[model samples]
Target: METTPAPSNVDPNRTLLLVDDDDILRERLARALAKRGYAVTTAPSVAAGITAARSNPPRYAVCDLRLADGNGLDVIAAIRDINPDARVVMLTGYGNIATAVAAVKAGAVDYMAKPADADDIDAALQASGDTKPEPPDRPMSADRVRWEHINRIYELCERNVSETARRLNMHRRTLQRILAKHSPR
Candidate 1:
């Protein structure tokens, strides 16, 4: 029987490590990436991710910026230590310029906000050196930006609702309501 070759864009070493605390997101992304031809391994925290990387380094990684146990930047550092050429992408619910810069400095090739679909991630993973990926067709709306900013401040305040509210100059009850709701698209 004759067989067709894999696409040139697909890496020969298709090993990928995905580290995210969100169980549903992790599984869904893993399945989608697998369909795209990656051999995926997943972890739920910084420690697990580091252990996995040390045991069997991956050629690509998608790590959450805020893990249950610790920051995902630590995982990126570990992966880079194991294989400097590894392509790591940072995913965060609280997306901001500072965190994105930090992710890049920590060895992540790209930074994506939460709710990133599998297709967008796949494209990012396939991006070659120095080549910028296409911008999102629908950027986050103003409401979404406000939501992200509020969430970022909340995190910075160590998740203290009152402190976040004070910093954002929003009423505590109002901030609480916002926090209770899902992020705006």
Candidate 2:
């Protein structure tokens, strides 16, 4: 879908909220974002982040999908309530396409893995897409989530079916069954 550009010049009125469970990373990101000319508020958990967003909605938000109290979606929802126009981004270390798709479905302008730089955050805020795509083309679905999870586990296990199955809380036979059902001959 087509997108518009947010103002290139940083606006003082456009503040940012940085939400992550990692204290050190959150502090570092907060300082970095502040230096970039954004008035930033940092939160250590989903609940705290939601509280902060409710108090004063930010124009931009960078949130970790996994948080101590809950998922970042709750924080994103709070921000939406406070400021529907705010651009939200989900930053996660568990960089699975499934989660990224889910984040976008949950109202993120975009979703990116962690260890991202300021530029990534900037790009996400400038994206004009909504939580869901326009008609016809839809977001990822349950089958995608399951397949993604299975593939991720398999990758970690170096394609060892037993190991992947154990980690996924499924039997080896079950994993094999799914793989056999899904894999191309």
Each candidate's lDDT (Cα)?
0.85, 0.75
Cα misplacement distance, residue 122 of candidate 1 (Å): 1.3
Provide the global lDDT of candidate 1 against the true structure: 0.85
The 10-residue segment of model 2 with minimum total lDDT is 1-10
Q: Mind giving the per-residue lDDT tens digits that candidate 1 earns over 1-185?
A: 01123334555598889999988888888878877888788999999999989887899999999998999999999999999999988999877899999999999989998767787887788899968678877777889877877887897799999899888889999999999999887
lDDT of 1 at 63: 96
Candidate 2 regions off by >4 Å?
Answer: 1-10, 128-185
